[model samples]
Target: MAEHPAYPVGLRLTGRRVVVLGGGQVAQRRLPALVAAGADVVLVSPEATPSVEAMADAGEITWARRPYQDGDLADAWYALIATSDPDANARASAEAERHRVWCVRSDDADAATAWTPATGHSEGVTVAVLTTSARGRDPRHTAAIRDAVVEGLRDGTLVAPHHRTRTPGVALVGGGPGDPDLITVRGRRLLAEADVVIADRLGPRDLLAELPPHVEVIDAAKIPYGRYMAQEAINNALIEHAKQGKSVVRLKGGDPFVFGRGMEEVQALAEAGIPCTVVPGISSSISVPGAAGIPVTHRGVAHEFTVVSGHVAPDDERSLVDWPSLARLTGTLVILMGVDKIGRIAETLIAHGRSPDTPVALVQEGTTAAQRRVDATLATVAETVRAEDVKPPAVIVVGAVVTVGPATAG
Candidate 1:
């Protein structure tokens, strides 16, 4: 006789007990989705990955610091058996079966009562896929299908329009490191729904170009507020558009609060009684350096990393940065908006006791197709930058961490 088909249903596991019988990679991967669904998860294993341990430390999940016992799943609404030891997995599955709780076994799906589906989430929707006809077959096919569905949803090809009940508001979104693909799924979805986009020069311009023709795209740099009133004008634009019942998106480059003046806009909106939401992006400070294969913080290399704005010259009266203190650090120094003043900045660091030979890397147009790197040291960076004609919007990395990454140079 043929076996009964496995039922496919979304479990409302919020505030409900769930038992995870492993702490390795498979369990690590499944725990996040369960935690995200508000499951009261208890992970059982003598050891766990650093990520799982971190989650336990953060109170996101409970960790039983020992191997699974027979009654581990007695109160669990669901159980996932993911231990590497087949014997342990079998014992956990057997206990779950006795308790009448459905079990998903990572080691052997045919020997399990449940199968975990390939899942993808976009906007407010979650998609889960499981192939019944090819049960216990290769998971790659299902994962591929999931990716295709997600791509369609992101690009507006798979639209499931929902009625908006809330009043129009502003979203301070960070477009990561000028790469269109680097923007978060939430950020991209919000961008597609925006009626008006007030964009900065450093944001992902390609994504802006893809906006629907009916949407209004304002150039923030060209805001007609003169030089001094530019910020005020942008704030007014966001408030005015939102008051008109239009969804306004103040899209900026990198994480909104990382030298992006996002809070200023949020404050302006709050005083105007406009609702505001912030969706942070991947900041270029760390992402740009990583793109160049430079880890900002490497074990035993850079214990600490500081990010500072180099827009103002070190000796300028308006500068608030303590160059002397920065020069004393043994960690990495990442400076943004410092290209124009890099020459002066480099000289200041060297003068403040930083080694004349400290490794420095200038990543221009980082994380993009036009990305280029120029290497130098404290004593020679200014000359090297000038010679390379490095422009603004480049990240300046200083310290041993630069040499520690794959793109290390003199």
Candidate 2:
């Protein structure tokens, strides 16, 4: 039992000497935070785990590559005594005490001068919880509390409206290939704080249901060669909401920059003097193929993978893709927004030098419950799409890599 309650304080260890006596699991877990805090850490250990060795190789910390010895903590501002040898730990702790340096012991917490708390970070706030009682300490309970507080803060469930300084701006967030769980933590946090969400139809539609009722959700769904909201109108909406002092989030499917025309929105926001943040999402170009058990690049089979926009036909004057050059390359080709132009694309690729027998796969509604894969060859892909009734928003993979994984039948 601790003699008194542990006083909580944030350590500014930047440029200060920190000594870690162990290079095992405990050190592996705690070293990263110490490095992130800009601490000049010296690790004293005969050997270390692979991860700790990686940090030393990267020059993040100095590894003594020997067991702890006397005077090891002579210049340390802080010490973590976690060596396998109990005697060594006791000697290090005694030395740290004699030198007036605060020390934490992994084995004996009560004997240590300092205790590491269960810590969590949300936004710019750090929550550290420590439970010290005459009975005993509960680390798991402390960790659970920390996780709850951080999660609440991140999701806006524990909102302190009076204390929050709401900054009005526009954020272009990638919703990540139709899976709500796949959305980045930063993106989800920003979404929870949004006052207005201009959502695309292809984005993770499930997340919209979780938004607070006060948030205005606008359907800016853009369909290929179909009825859809104009890009100019969407930009105007973002500018209007931001100028009105509202936090606006443009939630897009896959990556906002992967043929998503996200730059246009950023440029528009800049012209209107609105602060914009772009959070990248997992693009379906790679992720969709992966979700359907297809690797864009396989060893010996494919060395490179190219992502192209298939929204325009190869014969169209607006098309900018060099079909002849693409066919000459022996690599994987991932086409997005090309469901309608699959026939023209396949025909053009074949005419230029690509083999007609090359494997082709179309992954529809990838990473979602509605996901399905339709397999064909470059020669039969156009007809396969027609027979399968494959719709828009499917990723078309053309290469030998299409057959690299287990057979994915629709």
C-alpha lDDT score of every prediction, in listed order: 0.90, 0.91
TM-score for each of the candidates = 0.83, 0.94
TM-score of 1: 0.83
- lDDT agreement of model 1 with the native: 0.90
Candidate 1: clashing pairs of residues:
none
Give the per-residue lDDT digits (tens) of candidate 2, residues 168-194: 899999999998988888888899889
lDDT of 1 at 304: 95
Q: In angstroms, how far off is 405's CA in candidate 1?
A: 3.9
For model 1, residues 26-78, the per-residue Cα lDDT tens digits are: 98899999999999999999999999999999999999999988888988999
Query: Which consecutive 10 residues in model 1 have the weakest lDDT in total?
Result: 401-410
> How many angstroms is residue 67 displaced in model 2 relative to the true structure, after the best TM-score fit?
1.6
